[model samples]
Structure formats: structure tokens, C-alpha cells
Target: MATEHGVHAAHGSAAIANHAHPLDPLSAPEVERAAALCRQRHPSEQLRFVTIALEEPAKAAVAAFRAGGPIERRAAVVAIDRADGRVFEGRVDLAAGAVEAWTHRPGVQPYPILEEFADADRVIRADARWQAALRRRGVTDLDRVQIDPWPAGNFGDPAEEGRRILRGIAYARDADDANGYARPIEGVVAVVDLNAREVIRVVDEGAAPVPAADARYDAAAQPRLRDDLRPLEIAQPEGPSFVIEGHRVRWQRWRMRVSLHPREGLVLHEVAYEDRGRVRPIAHRMGLSEMVVPYGDPSPGQYFKNAFDSGELGLGRSTNALTRGCDCLGEIAYLDGVVAGGDGAARVLPNAICIHEEDFNILWKHTRAAGQTEVRRSRRLVVSSWATVGNYDYGFYWYFYEDASIECEVRLTGIIQPMAVGDGPIPPTAHRVARNVAGPIHQHFFCMRVDADVDGGGNTVYEVDTHPLPPGPDNPHHNAFAPALTPIRSEAESARTVNAATGRHWRIVNPSRLNAVGEPVAYALLPGETVAMMAGEEAAVARRATFARRQLWVTQHAPDELYPAGTYPSMSKGGDGLPAFTAANRPLEDRDIVLWYVIGVNHIVRPEDFPITSVHRAGFALKPWGFFDANPALDVAPPAAACDCPPGECVHGHDGHEGHAHGAAR
Candidate 1:
């Protein structure tokens, strides 16, 4: 697979390209070289690399490229100690082939699985303390324990120190079966502190009450199972309707370059559509900024289930190596992703990104004179990727429509986190997503950071609100209404909740720019069905994901302020990331701004979601509010229906010589 993508690492040599494109992720060669340099500087202690990803080029530097300036890409590398939970940083100058900076940091928690697994083995390997805890839970076999690692937050306790922790679960894994979720060790949670690299304590939060049959998550144990159904195929006579030049895609009127990041997964760059004569700009850059899945169960061990998937763990790096024909239908274009592992070796993730064109219902249809209907079928360009974070597999997609509207969607599937269901009735706070397993009712929160450079850099977030008018002279009829748009003038006023029933939408527009009707040219964000976190205001999850509290949050653009939840939010206390970034209440109007839109499902687990849940999606649209001159697809030709003119006699009064030019005989 590495050879296929020209990224094959042979022995001690790196096969990654060292060239730095604006949107390109960190290369293996850059990482390998950077890690070697960092280790040389810190010769005393052993360092294990954790995250080796690109420190994205700033927007200002990116903007300079429009004038044909050189863009330099840098790599941000982080590593942890093999013995103690100490964090270190290494920054590499990719172009100059040098390590730009190195720093030894404290208080930053570690997340590399290798470090935790090593530390956990030291403590829980036939240790008398953990073995006693396991015996109380009725598990006799001490050999089948699977130690799962998680970040240990400081929780703002003045007495507590920062480090990593391991949650020990029972392993029911077999060579042929893939139901690790169903094999949780009931009634015992081993709390090993990696900071101390020893067993500090054990928390005996007994498992959920249910029968033993609930643990059967194997395919053969599935209820209501039936034989495999008939085969279906998606055949394209003309092959795929799109062209993939490297990772750049061109489908219908859409044009964009796609890449996968270690945290953002599928990222679309220089996204635009062909409209009228010229190519117009849509978004300079966009992707899933961050996501948080917080469980609602309030037990001691459960309340801390506010998992920040992207920040805490590299969700983008966890993308599944997508399978062809099964993951998508029709002609698909596969793109490989490259990432550096803890060993500092670049690993090639093949088919991590998928691109295809899909027939999307109706674009526009009209019954013309003589019942001559002009109907155009819409075909959209879809760029998709999926990531599995522990018990959940998340799918992210970017769809570009012919009418220049962009849709960003997320699909949640995969097994729900299981608890040991003992012999008793399940609790009321959780729903049974499976036969006997209970799924704690939780909210899946997603925040997308949109750098909507609508008609260039200077833009304002104009909020349109529809309100009921009073019974005065202004409203002669009782059904009269009034609509107004208030420009978000300051950061303090930028945070807004979803007013779904009121037809509310935030328009990103440049006040100096106007359309044909003298209206401010803009693009509006239509946030679909979503649920914010229900945790208390003072909760750690709520504080970290402050951007999730509202539907639309706009702040002055700062390249460093990328994630809504602050950078390195794994074990952070409250008052960081967006909350701290926006506390200045910076003026928002007529300035470069970044908008964060939170969208997700209000998941109350249904019985059918067990074993593996089907895909349930939530989405939002970036539509041309006043950004376009007119309907971008208006000039698109209608689909060829049964034409009355018939034969080769020019379908809609065009000369049949389109395929040929009839000049002189020459």
C-alpha cells in the first residue's frame, strides 16, 4: 500500500515527499528528521513521540500566496517519556531541514497508547491489588485483561497531579470475532496512575443490571438475523463522472483540493464552483473543527465520560481504511493518508478518503408551456471519510451542489459503549440500545470551524431574525410580521442559540460588497437538527466545549485559535479555548472572522442500535444568501427526456453540428 502511494519507507529511509503545499499534512520525512533532532537535544531522557502533525500555515501567510509568494509548512511534534508522564515539544522547519525549536513542558498529560500500556503492565501484571479487585467482580482469569488508557484530568483539584490513567476491561477478543465492546469486565474499574506508574486505587462502580445474554454481540448471536439478501450493483457505463488529479477533484461544476488531517480528517481547500463566466470563491478552508461525545450518566466513573474525541484523541488519524463498493456506490476515487506513528515512522493509510459523484434527487423542475417540463437532475460531488473513536465510528462528508450550496454532514454509527449487564432491570437514565446492554442517553456534539472568506477576507456576520409584529398601525393585519438583521458587532454578541422555528440564520457578508439589488452579498449558515451538551455550566465538558453551548459563534479570526476547544484540551480545566479566546469581546463587524457552528443528534438510544448502529446523520448548509449574482445552476441544461423533436434533429433547436463543425469542405 505504501508503494502504491509512493510513500513506501524502506528500512531506515523515509519515502515521504518533503515539499510543503499550503494544505498538505506533515510528511514522514519531516517527522522522522524532526524526531531524530529532538532526541539528540534531549540525550538524557528517553522520549516517545505522540502527535506528529502539521502546524498549519497562518491565514495571513496563506493569503500572501495569492500574490504568488512562497508558503513554508512547519511540523508540530509532541512526545512523552517512556518511564514518567512528561511531555516534550519539537518544531521542525520542513523546508530548511532543521529543528526550529524544542521545549520541555510540564503539567501536559500524555495520551500515547504505548506509554500507558507499558505503565499499566508494570502495575496490573499479576499485581495483588488489581487481582483482588477483579476477583470481587467475579472474573477469575487474570490473563485476559485488556488495559484501556485514558487521560487523567486534573479536575482543578489543588492536591491532584497531572498524568495518564488506564481503565482495565476484560478481553473477549477471538481471531474471528470483532465484539470487544460486548466483553467489558463487570463491576471493576482498575485506576492505575501512570504519573506514578503504579496502582494508586480501584473504583468498584458495579456493572449495569441485566442478564448474561446481553454480552453476546457476536454476529451469530444477533437476534432476528436472516440470510444475506440478493446482490445489487451500481454500474456506470461511462465510468466515473469525475476527474481526480492527485487529490484535487473536479465534478460537474465543482473544483477543490481534498486532504486528510490527523484531527480534521477530510479537509477541503480552495473550494469553489464554476458560475457564469468566472470562477467564484466559496470557502477558503473548512472541516470538522472538533467533536465531543459526553455521556449523561452521573455516576462517579461515568460523569467524566465527557470525551473530547478530536482533541483528546486523534480521531482523524483513526479513520478506517475504507473498502471499495461497500463504503460507497458508483465510481469512487480513493486517496491515501500519511501519518507518523509513535516510532516516528510514516505509515500510509490507504483509501482513507473517498470521492464520488451522486445523483441527488431534484435540482429544479418546471412544467413549461404545452406541458413541456424542463427538469434538471442534480449531481453532487461527495468527499467522505470515516473515523472510529473507541466504541463509535463517525463519518464526515462534504457535498458540493450544482447550485453552489455546500453541505457538511456527520454520520454516527458503530457500537455503543457497553456496560456489564448483570441480573436485574436496567436503569431509567439509560436506554437499551441492544438486547440487554444499556446505552447511556447522551448528546453527540460537533463543532465545525468555518473560515468563510465570502467575497474575500473582510466580512461580517449579519443575523436575520423574523419576529411577530404588534397589533398597531404598522401591522394592520394581525398576521403581520417584521424581519430585521442585526450585524454581530462584537464578540460578546456573537454567541447565539438556534432559533429553529423563527427562520433565523447568520449571513456572512462584506458590508462594502453589494449584489445586483444593492443587498449585502453573503452566504447564510442553516444549522439543522442539533442538541448541545446538557451538562451544567461549571462542568469540565461544558467549559471545554464552550462553542457547543450556542448554535452559531463568531469571533475575530486568529490562526492559532483554530479549535473551539483550546489546543491540548485533553486534561484541561475550565476557561480555555473558545471561552478564553473570545473573552476579550473583540469587535466582530467589518473584520476577518471565524464562525463555529455546532450540530449533532439528540441520541436517545433505540433498541435497534445494538451490536453495530446504523448510520444516523445531522447536517448544515452554506447557501448563497446574496453571495451569487443569481441561481448558479439556472444555465444548466435539462436532462434529456423524450424529446418531441426526436432523432438527430437537434433536441432544443440547436444545430446537430455541436459534435462537428460544418464549415467549407476543407
Candidate 2:
């Protein structure tokens, strides 16, 4: 008798057909017997039979496993269809003992039997290797390890599986914490016991956290001082003391403030005052005084121009036009001396001069030019750098003043481009370079300022020099045939011929030349394929300036010396007592100084800057490297208990919020 999909009369006893048949039938007793026989064949095996419904096999299997139990000690035996090889495996100890079977075809046995067996000793052996790998790789925390099962057809030996587990653990452990700390936890090791076929232990071998003073560095040599700079008794304001507008000035830690009439800009007051008490200059370290000059009653043009030229205000008799020129003027107010204010009488003490004319101008000019409306509203820019500590000596470096000033300037320049709204498209060439006359052409301008304090026990710092770009089609001054492409031809062939007309033009063409907007068009530089063009000459110039400044700072300050050189570049602490380029430096301490910078493109005003100018600014602050050594999120661990939210409404609630009432409880 024949029945359903693949059932038919086999022998007279109705045996299930194998291979060619659409369905095969085996009784529940037959399946159980096959399982028992396989277990017997592999005597040291711990096994369980896993049955999955045919229609929704994979999901059902995973759901059962996720309902977790003590399966770590047993091997999973899965039952699957002969046609499609999907297996449902689970922890052996968790599976129910009863066996059941079913067949799609009538007249066939209700269950189909397929037996698979694995040595329990092999799994145990693999777990041991996995544990060893974790120890070798310095993995200590098991709770944080993530496990991903191998695919069905590509199963591996226990050792290999253990390695995969260790790899996953390493990846999960290496992620940066929210506070940017990136160090791996110490002395932690994860181990597996092969014979037991289980993960035996998660060990924590890391050292105890210590305060900065107890760290390896010499703390006694670096004396600690109070943050305040006020003195005890003051003989009424005397000598050539100048009055400043202190109202509305914001007070900052490690910095002092003095106000000047707006019209005075950045000019220094012609007054000299002396302190009247015994003081330790080193105790007032990191304190900087700022003289804020308001733009009092000046013509708008003067105000803007003065702000722009503020970098030219303070060059002592030096006449170097490019390196030492100062055509700007402004009022100066900065922390010059430390004072004690106890004993009912304030007396002046030895002071640390944080700001000086030259260094101030260098910072002022660079920032002013970069952030000016006329320049920033036109270009897109990105700037980033790393810091190191010991360039001069072990002494603290006060480079934050210069960095902060520059950052403030870039903030004023404001170059962020507004994103297009929904359904709006970005211009194809918005980030591309200009081609010929038909497409839009963009021109960029840049100005830089550099200054250093000569009075802070250091010689005149060298002004950073920059490299000029090679003259070519993109270089307006050198490319002889650049003017011919006033209006480009539409046909690609015509443009190519025109571009290659002159042998000299061909020589300089770069065939890879990008359009004005920086997008790559059909050009023949590398094979016949089109590619994006290189950044324009203006960008190259800015890049050179930034690079030169970084190199000069690192070389001059090498982090191992005492009294590290003070410059915008010297702000970060590094290994060997210098600033670091990578994230591996020691943590930043309370007295450490930091420098920050921001730079971007400037526009010289073209039709492209219509409506309002658009500017893109990018820069970062330099702190002592590795300032965050611990896991920043560890302090915020979640509660262990589950929340009490009622079914549907509280599915998203976290564990601790269960019993907490929201709104008015009924």
C-alpha cells in the first residue's frame, strides 16, 4: 500500500525507505535505540537527543537553548531531517528523557532515525586549550566574555573552538570605555577545565588602583600648590598701577583676568608694579593672567581691523617682517605675580608670569585670522594632533593659554556646513575640486601667526617655517596654459584633446587633475579609470603649516627635560617625560597643563559664499596622554535585580526600575 509523499510498500513488513524516498518513517523506539547505541559506542560521552519541528526548526532550537539551564557538562545531540540538514542541539543535562518521533508520509514509520556521536573527552580537551589561550592572551574576566557558536557544517575540534571563544573575549575587552580610557585590565585570566568539560574559573590578577602621588613618578620633586593666586595683605594700589575694567569678566581656574577699554584692543598698559612679600614662584604654577580689552567706542571698521591685526601688536625692537612683525595693538592683562591674602593685610609675593607679549601675539594673530568672518565663511577644514609631556624638563608646561586662545579664535570663524534637509540632495561636486571654467571655481586663502615668550627663562623660539606647493595647472602663478580652459567643452573627448594640446601642459596636467570642487572626472593619470583628485594647493599650504608646528614642538620639547619648552605644541605630557603621540602616556594630573587648537578653510569672498559664508572647523584639545586609565563606566554598573514593570508597557525598563512608580499609581 502507498501513502502520502514518499510512502510505498517496501518489504511485506513495511520498512521505511531511505535515500530516494521523499519521506522515511522510523518509530520512536527505533530513534531511542539508535541514540542508546551511539552513546554505547562512544562510552565516555554525555549525550542528549534534540528534536526540532520541521517547519520552524532553527528558531525553535535557538529559543529552547536561550531558556538556559545546566548544559555546560553535557554534549548536545541534535535530530534533523535527512533531506535538509538542520540540527537542534542543546545542553545534554537540560533535555527531557522521553523520546518522540513523527513522519510526513502515511504508511511510513512516525519517526526517522539519524545518529551522530562525538567523544566527550575531545570537548574536555578543547576547553583546556581555550582556557590556556585566554591566560596567554591576558584574558581574566569570564563574565564579560561573549560566546558565538560555530556554523553547523564547519564545526572544529575543542581547542579551536576555545581559541574562537578567547578571541571574542579579547575583542570585547579591548573596546574603549565611555570616558576614553583604553588600557586593558591587568592580571585577569580565564581558564577552562578539559576533563570537567566546563569553564572552571575567571581570575582577577590586576593590581590595586593608586593615587597619582604614589605612582612611579617623583612627586616630591614636583611640589603641590593651592589653585588660588590671591595674597594676604595689600598696601593700597600704588606705583604705576593701571586701572582695568574687571566687570563682567569670567574667572577661570589657573588663569587670571583683567579688563581693558575696548578701544585699547591688545595694547599693554604702561605700568610696572612690584610685589611686597616673600613668595615661591613655583607654588603659583599653571596660573595665567589674561588682560581683556573691550572694543570701547571705536569705529566698526577699526574694531574689526584691530581684531584681525592683533597679532602685530607686541614685537619689542625686533624687525623681522615675516617672523617678528607685529602690526596689531591691544591691551595686556595676565597673571604676573602671586599674592597672599590672609593676616588682614594682602602682600604681593613672587609670581609666575603666564602671559608675555610675544607668545600672546602669536596666539592672538593665528586665532584671529583663522576665525575671521571674511575667511572661515568660505572653506572646509579639519585639524588634529597628539600631545607629549617632558620636552623641557620634568617641570609642568603651561601651554594651555596659547591653545585655548587659538581654539577661541577658530570658534569665532565658525565653518560648519548645514546639512541638507529630507529628500534634498548634496551637490555632486560640493567636496570636489574645480575643473574648467564651466563648473564653479573656488579659491582659498590662509594666514598664520606664531609667537613665544622670551622672558620665561628661554631663548627666542624659532618661527615655524612652511613648504610651498609646486607650481602646476592648479598653481595659478606657474601653469602657462591654465587660462585656455575658460569654458570647458561638454564632450569628454574634446576636453581631453584640449587638455593635451600643449606638450608642456601635458607634462604638468597630472591627467589626474581634479575639478575646482575636488571631484575626480575622466582624467588619465593611473590607467583609464577616473579617481578623486588630490586636495588643492591651498589645503597643502595649511597642512604644511600644521605639520611644521607639530614637528618643531616635539623636537624642541622632547618630554624628558626639566622646564619643558612652553608653546602651543608643548601642552601634552608624554613618555620619557615628554608629550605622547599615541594614547599610551601616563594619566593627566590636577596641575598638568593642556593645549588645544582649531583650524579650517577661509574664504576670500566669491559668488559661492552667497547669503552667508559656510565654514568647517576641526581641532582637538591635548591632555596628558592616557589620563583615563580605569574603565570609566565601571562606576555606573547596572543593578542585579529585574524590574517589576507589568508585561507590555515595561519591556524597555531596566532592572532597577521595576518597583519604581511612574505618573500616579492606580
Candidate 3:
């Protein structure tokens, strides 16, 4: 980021385009060309570009594409005219250098541009009322204060209606690199109009003094360091066991194509696995559609803290530049992502995605009484990326295992959003972390969209749960339990929650494909740590992000229905995405379907989570259920010997007649 007007601006560089794959991201030249084309048609200096990225072709076109075939390249663009607050959408044909379509969107607000954040900071700091409020808290130095502009959520205030607004949160900093979050200036909120670039109101409710103590965790600020740790290293002598061509990856029996979306970040397409000599498709596309972080506090300074990270602030644009040994280990492959800044100039972020393989201890091991032992190692392919949105950091990891299972994990870590506390008893909704500093309770809910094609396209979803039978004719001993499978026949019955007491799971099966025992080939979704939305049903947070209210939702596959939250969630009223799509009550049995699974983490702030938080993980898994005849890893070879022991001694366990007893060490 570059410093401009005492605020950081987004980074980018101009370049040319020479794309090879049709699904590849839009190049720098394409972004510049698209913006220029829009500017020509609009002919206004007030137009600011919001989003500029590659417009993906239809699924049929991508499926029929060959290596050097005819391609029709296009770009999707969104811009807003700052003068009248009118939003525009356009499409550009790169090859012909022509505008394909241009339309105006009424009564909608797109995501905020990166420059507006800086502009908001500049405007708030210059306001006399904001300065007076700061002086009332005994803070006079303006340069040392940090002002963060947050999306001002709609609350039905007539004064703030039909206007773009941002709330300002301020903190006192000791130095340039010091932790500003350690000292929050609470009870002062600045409401600023983005288009007008002026402070609308400054509310000062309390006079809590800022904490003077500094909480710096850098090595230079520490007095001593640990000296008893040893370095551990991992190496792959023969290199990795996977092959990559462009965006396509092949490892072991798994195959898929990876792409970077401007909002969704990492997206997987055509995920399939090979059994024997046949390739079977599992999913057509999978990615994180939307995620929300809603705070529990309802004070004047904290009520409007619910933010749609992926929709309001683009996760793909917030990616971090990962380092080699620090972020990943062993033999690793990196992929760069191209994204545009506020100026619609594309730039390549180096090492935005990391790919590697990890040894997962053991796949399976057994020892027989006949003095024979066998063990095989387990390995998984990992594709991961990280994004830092304001005061929090997030990691998205996709793991593919040898036994034909897929796991998607979300790791959360970073500085917690802090609040200033007085010398009274602490509030129940927060925990005191440092001197006069409190950490607020919050929840992070993530929605994953899986376009499943269980053997082919047509599939059905069933809710499977275990029910114990009564001790009548069914169970004489009163210990008989069996699974009860119920088909979800319509969208009306698709929204459901997890019943962990019954070991419940949802399965997607192809009714046309039968397994060896006449069962449908299927994959089951195993829910991990999850919770329902804590907000009330009528609350604005719950209404805007309705996907989080339920753990599982099955809907008919539609290309335009991508985001779990609607296309524009910033300051949205409510009742958009999931609720609107499921209103049709379409048939879901034996039809092309999509699964929307929500993972929730209820974060109760701890004292140890103050200065910086350790990684906290939450996600779900998909396991093959009746899709395979037997164990898929049965053909995996045994691991090589770790020591120079004789071959027979390593595997042969001693029986009653001990002959060369095997040592405890492998």
C-alpha cells in the first residue's frame, strides 16, 4: 500500500495481456481497456470503477473448449457516478474493443472502492466537531490517531436514508508501527457521508480515558526470548507427486481446476477422482460464497458492526503476500492472482495462493496375532490462501485426502476489535484483556456453495439420521438403532439444521447410478463445529445474511445464483439471497442441485486473545458414502523403513515362540 494524504492507498501496476486459458483472470491490459471503454460511453469524471474482472463464459463453453480453440474473451465491470449516486453495469468484448452492454441499476449500492476508505479518514480528521470530541477525551495530537472507516449499516434512519455513509472508529497510537488497537477511544462515533465527503454527526456519549499502557509483541520490544527450542525441517527429495498444467491439478487419483474470483477468492471446478481406470465427477464448482462477522455488543459505537467481508470488502482483493518457509513448508508451488485497484488497473500479487502436500501420520496400520504387521502412510494435497480484512485475518484451506474425502477448513487469527473500559466491573459481553482494554464477543459465519454432480448431473438429497427402535417386536433387547433416510422433495424443505444427537448427515446421490450392492453412488456431508445465527430472526443482521440461520440448504442449480447473500449486501434492507431463491419451491429430487452449507463459530472473547490471537479453525468435510465398493486406500503401498533393521524384523511381530523380538521403535 502506498501512503497518500496520510492514508494508505491500494497498489497496482500496468501491464499487457497474453492469456492462454479461457478461464484465466483478466489481465492488466484488459482491465485498463474495459475501464477506458466505460469512460468513453459515460464521458464523466465523476465515474469511479468498483469492480473489473473477467466475465466467465457459460459452463457449456468451458466444457467444450480445446487447447488453441476459438475463444470469446469478455470482462464484467461495475462503476458508480459519484455526482448522482447512480450505479452502472457494463460488459466489454476485449477482442473487438467494443462495449457489449451497459445498464443502470436503480436502488442498489455496490461495494465501496478502496480509495473511499482513505477519503473518509481524511474528511473525518478535518471536521471541527470530530476534533472537539477528541479533545474532550484529552487527546490533541491528530497525527497519532488512527481512523478506520466502516460500512454504515442501514437502520431505517430517515436522515441517513438514500445516502452513502461510513462510521469512523478511532484509536490512539504510540508510534507508527505500534499496536493502535491496544488503546481504543471509546464512546465517540463519527458518521460521514461518502459522496458529500463531510461529517454528518459526531456523538460523544462517554469520557473514558484511553489506556496509556502499550501492548507490543514484536521481538524488538521483548526483554528476553526462548533459547531451548530446536529447528525442525521437512524435505521432499524426489520433489512433489503432483502435475500441473495451467490451472488444472492432478495428484494421486484426484483432479481439479483452480481459479481466483475477485470476490470468492479460491474456486475449484470439475473436481473428480479416478477409480481403477474410470474418472467420476463429484462437483462442478465449490467456493466460499459469503461470510459475516456480527458483534454481540449493541452500544452506540458497536451496534452496526456486522460486515459482509466477501461482499462489502472483496476477499480476493484483500489477499496477503505469503512467504515461503513461514507460511508453508516442504516442496511448494505458488500461484499469482491478478486483481484491479480503484483505478481499474490490474496488478499481479505474487504468491497469493500456496499448494503443497503434507504427511498425515498414518493411513492405516494393523498387527495380526499370526506375527504379521502392515502399515501405510497417509498424504493430502493442500491448496490454501489468506486474506486480511481490517482487524482480522482469515485462511481458507482445501485438503484432498487419499481415501477420496475432501475437507475445507477456515482459520481465523489476528488482532481482536478492542474497546476501552472504565475502572468499574467488566461487562458480561466482553472480557478484560489488558489495562482498561476489553475484547467484544462476536460470531463468524461462513457459507460454502457446492455444485455437486454426484456421478453425473441429476442427483437427489436425503437427510439421514439414526433412530432407536422400541423394545417390541423390532428390538427384543431394547438396543436396536437404525438409520432413517428422508428425501428432500422440494425447496420448501431444504433449509434445515444439524441434529448432532442423532449423528445426522446429508447425502447427495445419483438415482441413476447404482453401486455393487444396488445402493446409489453418493457422498455425504459431515457437519463440523457449527451453530445457528445468534441474532433474532427479525434482526437486520439475520435478515441480510439468512444463509447463516440454517446449516444446510439444497437448491436447484442455477448459474446466476452464486452468492449466498445477494449480489449487493452493503447496506441492504433484507430478504435477498437464500430466501428469494427458495421461494420458487422447485423440485429437488433427481435434479441438478447445489448445496449451501454454513459453518458458524461463536467466539467468546478470552483474556489471552488480546494483543494477537492464535489460529482458531472451523469447517466441514465431505466423505464418500456407498460411492466406493470398498476402502479406496487399500492399494496404497507400505512406507519405507525408517531404520536399517532387517526386513523380516520390521514387519514380523513376535508370537509365543519369540524369534528376534521387534523393538518398540520403528
- Measured by TM-score, the strongest candidate is 3
Q: What clash count does candidate 2 reach?
A: 87
Sliding window of 10 residues with minimal summed lDDT for model 3? 2-11
lDDT tens digits, residues 1-666, model 1? 222323222121132233235666665566677767767766645577777778878876876865689877788888876655668887877778777888778866635445456767667665786677666655565665555554454356443446465555443333334466655555555567665777766666665432244345556776777779987776655567676555556777777777777766778877777766566666777888888887777655455676778877777678889898779887777777777677677776778888777878889977655445566778888889999887889999988888889899999998876655544576766776544467777889888888777877588998888988888887787898777889999988988988766789888887777888899888999888887668788877777777788888888988778778776777777567788878999999888888889996777877788767888989899999877768878776654333343344323323343333222212
Candidate 1 TM-score, C-alpha based: 0.89
**Tens digits of per-residue lDDT for model 2 on 239-258?**
11122121111111112222
Candidate 2: regions farther than 4 A off: 1-310, 313-409, 412-552, 555-598, 602-608, 621-630, 637-666
lDDT, residue 257, model 2: 23
- How many backbone overlaps does candidate 1 show? 1
Stretches off by above 4 angstroms in model 1 are 1-20, 113-125, 145-147, 154-160, 169-178, 207-211, 214-231, 421-426, 433-436, 640-666
Better of 1 and 2 by TM-score: 1
Clashes of each: 1, 87, 0
Top candidate, metric lDDT: 3
Which candidate, 1 or 2, would have the higher lDDT against the true structure? 1
Worst 10 residues of 1 by lDDT: 7-16
